[model samples]
Target: MTSAYPNGDSARDSQDVSQPKQSLFPDAIAIPPEVLARHRALVLDPATAARTKRGNRPISTVYRADSMLIPLREVQSLVPRPGQVSRSEINNELAKIGLQLRPRPEQEVIDGAPPELGVSVPLVRLEDAPADRAPDPWTALVALRDAFGDRVKHFGLDHLVLSASVAVEGAPVSHGGMVGGTPVSHGGSVGGGTVALHTGSRNPVALLMPQPPRPAKVPAGRRPVVAVLDTGIGPHPWWSKHRPGDPIIEVSQEFQDLLAAQEGQQQNPTELGPLNHPEDVPNEIQPLLGLIDSHAGHGTFVAGLVHQMCPAAKILSLRVLHTDGFSTEGSLLLALHWLAKRVESGDPDEMVDIVSLSLGFYPETTDPEKVLQVKAAIERLTSLGVLVVAAAGNDATTRPFMPAAFGHGTGSAASGVELLSGVGARNAPGHTTAAFSNWGEWISRWAPGDALVSTVPVWDGAALGGIRYPDGGGLGPWMRSAPDPDDLRSGFAVWAGTSFATPVVSGLLAQALAEDTTAKTDMVGRAKRALIATDAELARRYWQ
Candidate 1:
């Protein structure tokens, strides 16, 4: 029998399900030969070129600027005790090799690193320096590190990686035997205005149903708050109509630069636009519009999953990944620092209870320093009572992925963090883990990731009919038109990935925290309990 779970090819049959699909344009899409040639130069490796034939991959674009992180504390330690080194002294030393340092923006500061360690700065504009005098970016970074030793802390190329989620086109699988009824969409007013869409029999929300009402005695102000860090949450009606004011938090200009660069636009500070709409490029060049990368609307989809389980919990949408679903290690660190700073400085109202990271990188080197830096950041966030959840990755390998793997480590001040692997949906026979989920002892839990339906950015009707695939395949649109008059595919999609599995755990933890007053004192412990309880509940309802 065909598996009930989508993407449920047995692990024995498809060992490489976690690998990204080949480029949408197996044959080159239309573009000027010169532009295509220039794009080819941008590909960093043969593997990247093979996977990104149409040049939509961020790592294969001009934005792949070489950058390295320098720990300032180590640099400061190089000077004699009680002596101070001016910024110029550092710059002058770097100038010999055509490198420079600048202060990190205040908004990116967070408790990830000790204040005594000083801020980690990026080594920028290495290409502009005289080639003969200036060594390659990596060489210069290494020379500086050797000269300074541990005082330099860590030094390496700023690497790029994509989000873990994958968006697929189709209807979601049904789970009626366990949960009952097709999932229905719900609409409610916010800010005193009626929501544009309504929940009805024909328009059931996908993947989640409202929880039965909690006891009246449950404590107020203890709802678990979830923060989603991914591509910017698009302006989806479900979130806009449910939450008053803007649903997304404003990001800093430095963050904006990262997005702009990824989109292949001018990266100057003045040229950068807001993260929500970074540029006004045409569909041909816009990654999302062209379907060059499949990660568009990733954050919105993740938020939708969290909201489905914990409708009343506060959600903070932070955009870190570009539309192409790519971000550098430096960018990810900056985002983590920004969130940690808020939790550290903000009042109780602003503190976050859970952080969902659906994105991660596979380091090129085996050095543990970079991983250690990320671990420190996670430790810092958990230290402040925030639970961190990460996707075990789509690579389907036992090789550990960072942040997710970090969840298995000890010594953190708080201990609510864990890695989630993807499993097939309810009652899917013979398939436990989703074919795409990475696995190892490090994975803390598993959740259904196949054929998950959630929110997406509503597309303008212009593209509703369909767009012809560039290769002349019959009209193959990125999104299909809604069949039911009341149901709109414009604002929803069915996708599969370990990235989605993570929020399932986050939402379950949120629901558990919201109902259990006793768990309030130790939110991290509460999160752990919730994960165990949720696993049991799923097993009872579906696994048996």
Candidate 2:
């Protein structure tokens, strides 16, 4: 609901309220004021201070977000009916709470910054937790999302940034009734020698597993390389495809910033790596233009989907989103420039095969300005021979989203050089269109969404353990119904958004590329054509 650039950022709106409010950071573990006062005292306490001696500090606290909500009625109560606490008085009180609430642990996490200086980025969904902390971590996260409900934003957590915590086991309602897993063919998806993977089942991955890819004739595991420049990825089982030994990867900004720096330093030109780690490659994978104002985990989720689509592919997960979900124009410009520089270098070390983005360039710009950036970036990525895939956005009422709407619209032949693909979401047998799905005529391909489950950090899962009262988005109770109804693994979820849809298409797009060895640069164009040319249904529905 809050999407304006910041003279009054969403952060300001929360601050506009009266005092005694709880945190909006989803993982908030309430600490009584007395407890906080005690903790602060201990930090500066001579005795407590001496215990650490010279060491910086230890992570003694863990966030326990019992609930991610604050009743709207509670907030209404704080609104001092009309004449009370004029702006100046309100300002004084807010200034007071502001100072204290900030340094608070949950507050930092609200910005996607951990309370502790080095708490590796908090993973959002269960499928996206670190290897050691997968399923359980995600459980905690959902519990948190549920706990907060509409109170989530009011508590100061990133709006639209949520963790999905479904379980990934067999769906009793959907496992094709194949007992002991006789290997359902995944609804006609063959996974050998790059066959297309068609997943229309109600499985945890939102994807029915494709038949495993055949071992290369010579068993040559020529893994594909993929770069996901988004918020961040925490180690998760679904992410295990890229693992040489173990694959659930989420790159740290610490190390990535280091990788982003040209090897030689400020004075020297950027150097292509013998990319030591696969995670290090996303920044260098494609020409990243800039960061968009999306939540941190949004990028992380996109990264996870790309990895899911191409398990054999090496992934470079780039963290571009900020806590408030704002990435400056400069950041995106630099991101793109780096990719261009790497691609033009032509060094094998700098070579990248593909890039998929679930984000768009800055909105609010003139059509020409938007198109110029899109055209140029597509041109550059094409020149470098990198296949670029982007989301069409979730604006269901309009034409397909910007870059995808424009880029895919003109087609490869018209663009002449670069090939771009725009994807839309589809509702499968058990699925319904995402209430918020952005679709229409200009739409290209429809993959899937509408309660399609994916990944999120564990802690949030535990917090939002059950379905929150639907805030009016037509949220279904499938998450809580059983026969295990949808049989979603985490036992609770029914997300509605294009964010989910984009990833579904993203994965399939990668599958298309992975299938062809003599892959052409225009593969993206060809794929676009494949969907558009055959979209009689689309034509009848909206293009009439």
Candidate 3:
């Protein structure tokens, strides 16, 4: 899609006056093409069950399993109540296509949704099913929809969701060997003797400056919170330097409980474990190899952006994506549903004023029903007064990316809060779209995303690149040379993508809430007012 604004002074002047200037920073050292290629091949390989689709250009790569997620209520709607008739009928219908219901989790596990909202059953294809049947969950769902037709629609079967794929929205590697209409370059270099890595054609240079967190404007108990749903935040000095009882980042007790309960469930890989320590290395895909996964430190980087924007806001660091940059729609649904309920409880301590989603997917189809469960979960959060800021995606295509696209138009009254913000990536001055950023009407706002420096996990990956004076650290403190492209030991990186931009918008909204001393005291009232007012202020300045 063509950019929304043409280049030149007119474009710069068109930017909202209320928005701050987006400054450019030195880019991070680029990962070697072979390293990026290896990572992408592992994550997006069709043999791995991950799928990629082509549009005007290649979009995002979505990783999926063979299972389908069927909302229990929707399935129940297909059959009479158990008391009225035996419950065997539903199972019988599932058996027609060789699908079988997976075991259910404890009600407390999926708490926040209605008690009757039984665990979403993962219906697996029978190993012995006919060979001619649809091979994947989406195809099977389509077949079922076709067969059931109006019956499915009448029963609100929209929730028969795909256990679809969702990836971190950052530009990590090219999908289908293409990004922004060009093939990824196999080589690149930067000054300082460091080998600069290029993601697709976007250069990410190495930088050493970590954005320091400013003091909170609000007191500990009253600070607004922004929940970052992405690869978990790893160890970083920004949070470690804070005094006890006051932290810039934290995982809530409730979120901890959810993770603990979900652990070992096998239904979904939670990536659940301790965080904020050196031992808690962020590279999950190939730790032994010591190579940084394409998405390692993604959450930490995003959290740091928010920290710089609103230090007074407590960051709820939720780890939903694996270090490899992939997660399932089901896992996201669980987190979102749980969050909606957490907000519904009206506990000020647990209140999340903004949800920064730097991840999303392009659904196989645009039919609203295809995204029903995910959209419902998001709508539930917004209705409760939390503003969701999602990335418009990094593929530079106009294809609608989920959750973010929900922000398009005025939004539904059911959303309860102001509309969700679909954020696109703008270049340094933050005026025009980044070449790698997805655009089109669904994008509601744009922020500086190209080569912005922020905190990353202080990791020395296994990959061997860049030269050093001493072969094995024999020089100890003296040995130094070029930046290792994959090494994040500096705790800072110059990365680009809509992933980072979403947090800029989230942090700004949180800043507005934190600075609003005269706003209503109630959580919902304050957040709603802040969201509407901040959104309008943004619209006045950013939307062209």
Candidate 4:
């Protein structure tokens, strides 16, 4: 296959001299000139530009699978080693090079843990110092890592992770729709306010019904909880039966607080910002208009899939990604740390058995320890018996997507742990690997992900893609019209990605745990013992 990065750099095995065969799928689809211009226009809009700023830095909304984004002048590092190097000593060393650290107290401290999970500090480049042009935050980070070497293993770029969805032409970023290069979805005309999938010539019909009642026989504590760290859940008919005060689908206050801390006082509480894709705006690219964000109902769809396979499981919804399917590595790390804390709390009501992460990003460096902060957060959860399930991404490459790819390595936390499961996507009919699904030895399992039906928000778009006919001499609501592709009043949608597939495995794991007759108190221990068999059973049932 061609190099995953546009610049022809591979994230893994860079030293391999063997020629790589070309795959039929393209890494990126060619964006039409018109669509490209539309994206440029949106970027220049004042309202849109205002939303992209994280403090004084403007976050990049575009998706480049090969590259990772960190705050422009910031670097993340673990707490300094006491004897080897103190924080003050490190700052003093940086000062010699015309740089200093501005520690982030919020990100550095986890409520239950020491004030040392990891710290993202601003890297101020001194004007009078050696270098001519200011080095990008990533460049500065590499210098620091090289200087410290093995003494500091947990420091590097804080990647801006994205949903494992297909990138489309004219759209700001990939959210499981349209096609730029790798054709993940066939016959779908997306990004111009059209439906994401083209099942036929008609619009998708949502299933207008309430979700089936939950099985009441199983006690609340026995129901395994799967935490979905994606877009926040939206209003949907499927969840109507859930009782009041029940957190069947709710936001994670802990994660929200951490994110607020990261963004500082400029954070917008009502809207998830500094990490979202634009949806409300109409540009030349999305002319049909009134389209919801590409990945608006992502969390709802994922929650629906889990409920379908395992109704008894309680889903803990954590809003990490914006409706547009963009998230920061800092936010993801915070979410993971929160999950670890929940598992360690030993409170059955607060524990999560399976964590479904439907998003990931590729790191520029191949060394596993360089991205130690992310790997360590995931390891902490696994050590506490929480099962981590991550999407293998939709880039259709073997390049290691972090957190998911971490499942393949060996280290202090992963040496003998069997808790991490990396999942790839498959089609439901033939049960074969989807063409767009990332695959390799690192991927632990596969499941049906393409064209799968699930619940979505009960919202309608103003896009008038189909023919419309007015009633009563053009003075009333339209009596007849062609199907509106963006109209999701049906409260259901068909989406494809490893993002969807990861949840299938998570739901199945929860199902297995709920069905187990073993002691429920030690949920962590129970999950650890069942994970290996669960992995094998999933392979036998889905991959055989």
Point to the candidate with the largest lDDT: 4
TM-scores, all candidates, are: 0.64, 0.44, 0.73, 0.74
Candidate 4 clash pair list: 1-21, 28-181, 29-180, 29-181
Prediction RMSDs, each to the true structure = 12.1, 21.2, 8.5, 9.4
Number of backbone collisions per candidate: 7, 58, 15, 4
> lDDT for each of the candidates?
0.51, 0.36, 0.57, 0.60
Clash count in backbone of candidate 1: 7
Order candidates by lDDT, high to low.
4, 3, 1, 2
Given candidate 3, what's the lDDT at residue 188?
25
In the range 93-154, model 3's lDDT, one tens digit per residue, is 65676765444344223544642332334456657787674434433444555456544332
Better by TM-score, candidate 4 or 2: 4
Please provide, for model 4 over 297-384, each residue's C-alpha lDDT reduced to its tens digit, 9 standing for 90 to 100: 7788888899987888888888787555666676787778778887788786787888999998766443444566777788788877
Q: How high a TM-score does candidate 4 get? A: 0.74
Query: How far is 198's C-alpha from truth in model 1 (Å)?
Result: 31
Per-residue error (Å), model 2, residue 6: 34
lDDT for residue 391 in candidate 4, whole number 0-100: 91
